[model samples]
Target: MNRPQYILLPVSPIFIAISLIAAFLLNLMPWGQFIAAPDFVALVLVFWGVHQPRRVGIGTAFCLGLLMDVHDATLLGENALAYTLLSYCAIMMHRRVLWFRISTQAMHVLPLLLLAQAVQLLVRFIVSGKFPGWFYFVESFVSALLWPLITVLLLAPQRRAVDKDHTRPI
Candidate 1:
């Protein structure tokens, strides 16, 4: 069965910024110690990196990662390194990922999320000589699982109305 594709409106920079801030705030909540809590900032970074590579590239990811590092009080550049690589991987696969539905996009994102988490883990181990164990990876899995929900919520503002206007360009 073929599904009709709806054209999306151009996304606003302000909305993108707000979403990033909201994701950061979500991460800042008291759930940081919970093993099952997803990394909201990482998910949003991947989403934007894939959807608007030019607007949200490695630099943006790195900056956000640094903020996360400071917030977590971990070694500087731990998150920055992980997020920079995550943005790179997302940007590299953006073209292919766009062809799939949102559900499939989550599958595509899982490995990247895993890899980002691995990088962070490795950095932490190298610095502190400690491994947080398997539970450390739960965040990536949870983040991947939340991808579809995040996609819908973030894209809602950019979706055009059902009615079409001929004079307007999509």
Candidate 2:
């Protein structure tokens, strides 16, 4: 059965908005060093990169990172540069990533997440003239570990909708 294309699939804007909001919330949350959460915005960008490259590319990543920088009151362009680099890496590996299973994609995403965090750390150090401590790296690890879960949870609704459409008559 041919599927109808008008099944109200959630678009890029929704994802972008949710990501930005999550980033802001994560930044605002007072974790107090127990468990350093991953950068929500970065994770979101990766998800979009893997799933919707045409709509959420490096430009979008850079913009979102800039917003993060502004929201967190960090050095201007620090997150932006990191995010831009991450986005580029994601796009470069987009085809391969799409071919991988979700679990495999999480493994693949680990390095990109780490890379983004490392770049951001470097930028922050350059701007602030000091290191942010080892805890900063925790975000990268956490993000990598959370990638599969996040991908599944966030994308499940869309997948279900698509499945429903396919099973239904046109």
* lDDT (tens digit, per residue) of candidate 2 on 122-160: 877777789978877878878888888877667666644
Off by over 4 Å in 2: 1-16, 32-34, 161-170
lDDT of 1: 0.91
Tens-place lDDT per residue, model 1, 41-112, is: 899999998999989999989999999999999999999999999999999999999899988999999999
State each model's CA lDDT, in order. Answer: 0.91, 0.78
TM-score for each prediction?
0.92, 0.79
Q: How does candidate 1 fare on TM-score?
A: 0.92
lDDT of 2 at 98: 70
Residue 2, candidate 2: Cα error in Å is 24
Instruction: Quote the lDDT for 81 in model 2.
Output: 89
lDDT of 2 at 149: 85
Worst 10 contiguous positions by lDDT, candidate 2: 1-10
